[model samples]
Target: MEPASHGLRESATFDRATIHAIQRAAETGIYDIRGWGAKRRLPHFDDLLLLGASMSRYPLEGYRERCDTDVVLGTRHAKHPLRLSTPVTIAGMSFGALSAQAKEALGRGASEAGTSTTTGDGGMTPEERGHSKHLVYQYLPSRYGMNPDDLRAADAIEVVLGQGAKPGGGGMLLGQKITERVAGMRTLPVGIDQRSACRHPDWTGPDDLAIKILELREITDWEKPIYVKVGATRTYYDVKLAVHAGADVVVVDGMQGGTAATQDVFIEHVGIPTLAALPQAVRALQELGVHREVQLIVSGGIRGGADMAKALALGADAVAIGTAALIALGDNHPKYDAEYRRLGSAAGYFDDYQDGRDPAGISTQDEELAARLDPVDAGRRLANFLRVMTMEAQTLARACGKAHLLHLEPEDLVALTIESAAMARVPLAGTNWIPGAGL
Candidate 1:
């Protein structure tokens, strides 16, 4: 037998996946659309490390010390603000994108964990509202299922200007995921592709947004807090604008944030990373002298307690999770490995949430697939995850000699890479140099 011949290596710049994508696009004459966040890695929390106390700083005794994780959001101009027991909250994942059971599970889990859950593009669901103790209703460009009654029912309202997955682009719910119920909620034809408007139809700029906020406040009788959620791109300006628009809280979602469905190009190419966006958003708030008063919630690529702690250290009042929350609810459980494989993907690798064939039942619309998930069990799992995350964050806070998670500051952190140092605005490990500090 002839020995196997080695061919020339593929170009690192244009790898096999890139070549395949190009070929696919050429053949189909269409852009590749898929679910989830950026596939390419960027600077993230893993690149930063906590500088635990030893000689210079005092460390608290783990067993005897108390490390509070509570956070109050939307205090700037709200008559009633949301006081959460944990600094970690659930980010928005729309009803049309997530199964109703999944929505219920998210609400139950968030409520059980003493945090808050948010509505997404298709607006609020009764299942979610009924289960969530503190629910934040989203006002998106699509405005599907939006009503004054539901708005009044919410504990808070988040006016979503953009999402991290596709910053400038609108939302996409493929035809396959659009069931009759979803169609009814969105007031669209069943099995038809739905593209949410990129911008709000009624409002144009920040001034217009201020008026809308006032209108919402009036409609709700000034009872609910108003939050402005923006995709992280020009975050410094966007956050400033949101605050100026009378938002009680500002949520900045970075590129690593997930979506149920969007063009793959947008997810990979658009928006800034969470580590890069957080400091800018904080700076904007500080510039306006509303850093804490107009609370900031940072999202995107927040995986565990460490990420939450890092966000808090960087001056975010709280952190929000979407992909991580779904994972906690069993979106890609190893138990469903066989089913995932059958769908041309494997557990931990499935990203076809747009197709609505999720084996874990969290992202599907089919009755049998959706029925696979028990909301109670999923909620319990999510609650456990949240508890673990909170505990982990508290552990780090105590190590940094902080009595509360909010007391954690940038001084408690150091970056392992120049990119991370620049993005997180932290000093490099083994050096006092913070890239771009003097600039």
Candidate 2:
């Protein structure tokens, strides 16, 4: 007899109490960070602490400091300027992963907050394009739902080299969520696992990609701003090549960014983190003498104001958010905790985004499930969150004595932890600091 199965040790090493802890059980589902694991918790903007102005430095006021967050992304060459009131933007997430209502909500919020929202793996939808004031059309490797009309409709175009979630691998539209609509849009069979091509079907390398970008610009009459987005691998080289290839902007997504649906192994195993990639991308752009000329948008794990400020100070022209926006739109609400557990997962822990069974209704395509979410309410909440993030970012910029948020520099920062120092490129607090170049 097995010594009468004493407490939480149903899984050995873990005691019965540990097994009973809902948070512990949900570890595999959520709260797991890429690269780091159960051991290291990501410090929020509130955590890891802040060091205010001292004898050496002077502080600025919350209200008195001039915090100009205005950004003109593609004014150098484009016929139209990609002007934004805030430095925060929205990352691309799929139509299949989210209902049409959700996409519309993102557009409404981003537009209201003076930022841009991206189209996803699926092609441009009329709702998204119509609602978004500054819409970006994503030319993905998969090319799902892509057409000439969308290319014309977009304010900007992003040629996707890779996504941070599964850098080299293509994505799968699982059988469960592959409805007739999604199937027809992708030109694939229904109720089957649809695999998107990993590499682009047409061109192979940088030289060929340059021609392709030109072809697109010509096709669009050189009116739209063309961007190139790549996962954070070989970023220094990729950023240089993307600029050479004639990108007006470069969107670099880091490993911690969320995906609509991807393999668990892929989500956890691949790519460099955002903290490691931002500096290299900036260094590359600086080397090319186009650091701010060709804008750089950094995505992945951008939660609050400090992250936005830190990313900008390190060289990102703008920051994009995905998971955090979903949270603002009522994801993981305790109101659905009972229903979430009924699905064998709790609200905060549920990340099975593939099956279209989300209780919060943010990530599902089912009629009843999608209806659970009201787009108007969700959009308002997201707009409010965007406002708060912008406000906080401005506050921090002011505190650092910077006239504008774009004026924030590494000199204004001091890292509380070793990781923060390396990631933020700031000196350690209370000491003479050194920086590491990850090679």
Candidate 3:
């Protein structure tokens, strides 16, 4: 069955020729196994930060002076608009992968911060729904826990096309974290690893996706905003399509985005980075005249005030956080170095959320491990982080001579690195690359 490997090999840019040999070795049980992006370190948002105003710039009062973070997400094309009191929101992480307490904590934190929380591949949980003032029901391809009642109760509905960690990939839930409760939610056989299909069951392209949006809107009787969430890969085209499909809001998630559990290969090898994605999403919105009409929420490795400010400057109306929130809830602290090392990962670098062995206790289904986390405290930390992000974003906005966070412009940015500059399409500090210098 392996006859044609001799001729076409010359012209092939990439070939599956090595896979045959590799699979055989893997079949004999692995040794020093590593996955994509597993061995290589990529530039994260934390690698660079923003510099605030100086003599030529004015600062905004953190405690007072009206820094409005309010955003109306669905007004552009929705009968019942989705409103947020702040620009920072929570990205979806499944309840099973993250203990119920963690999901509740996220809800509590977002509520305290005056924003929204999203459901993951699994359906809505009463605890999360009750705590989150604004709950977005996710309609992922898996259709797990999906019910009409949940959809009816949602403040909005998000049709998930792709996520940042694995843009064109599927969702994964490791067997260890698949508790009975989780199993029931996903309707899968107990103790088996589950993978969600990447493609939607009903649609293929954006045009079909638009119809799906319309159908959902009609199903809800136009009472809720319809949103489209796509990974950062093709934000420009996807955002434009989401708007054309009558989406009231488009959320762009970047590669650095978090997941409960995925193969290291999927996490690192796939998707565009958030820094590169925000601008593309904004451009799409602007071209469609829905830049602010419909809203844009960006996520991926967003950790602090600097990231939030940078995202807003790049033209996002709002932002979402995942890993950072977990950190706020006490993930990867040095105290857990011993436990992390036991799992073959360092304390500050663990990403195996599906193992049911999170040292921080925020991402485990094991009762004892889950109990180690205090939701009340974690929620408070998340709120504080959100406040700081707001403060920083406001400060940057004022320094740029803008009165509101939404007014922060690309003109205020100078690339910290060449790759960032090229990908973001911005100029170096002293370059003519920025045609609109100070708009």
Of candidates 2 and 1, the better by lDDT? 1
Give the per-residue lDDT of model 1 (tens digit) for 174-229: 98889999999899999998989999999999999999999999999888999999
Candidate-wise lDDT, in order: 0.93, 0.79, 0.79
Candidate 3, poorest ten consecutive residues by summed lDDT: 31-40
Candidate 2 lDDT at 116 equals 89
lDDT of 2 by residue, 1-439 (tens): 5655654235655666455555654865553222111111343232233444668766677877567889977654567657889989888887876888888889989998888898988787777888899988889889999998889888888899987776787777677778887787788888887777889999998998999999998888888888899987888999999999889999998887787777656776777778777888998999999989999999878889888988887888999898889888887788999988997778677666676777878787787888888878888899999999988888877777777889877676666777767765667777657458443
Name the candidate that leads on TM-score.
Answer: 1
Model 1 stretches astray by more than 4 angstroms: 1-8
Error of 2 at 227 (Å): 1.3
Error of 2 at 301 (Å): 0.5
TM-score against native, each model = 0.97, 0.88, 0.87
Candidate 3 RMSD computed on C-alpha atoms after optimal superposition onto the true structure: 7.3
Cα lDDT over the full model 2: 0.79
Pairs that clash in candidate 1: none
Best by lDDT: 1
Candidate 2 regions exceeding 4 Å error are: 1-51, 54-58, 435-439
Pairs of residues at least 3 apart in sequence or in different chains that clash in candidate 3: none
Indicate the residue-level lDDT of 378 in model 2.
88
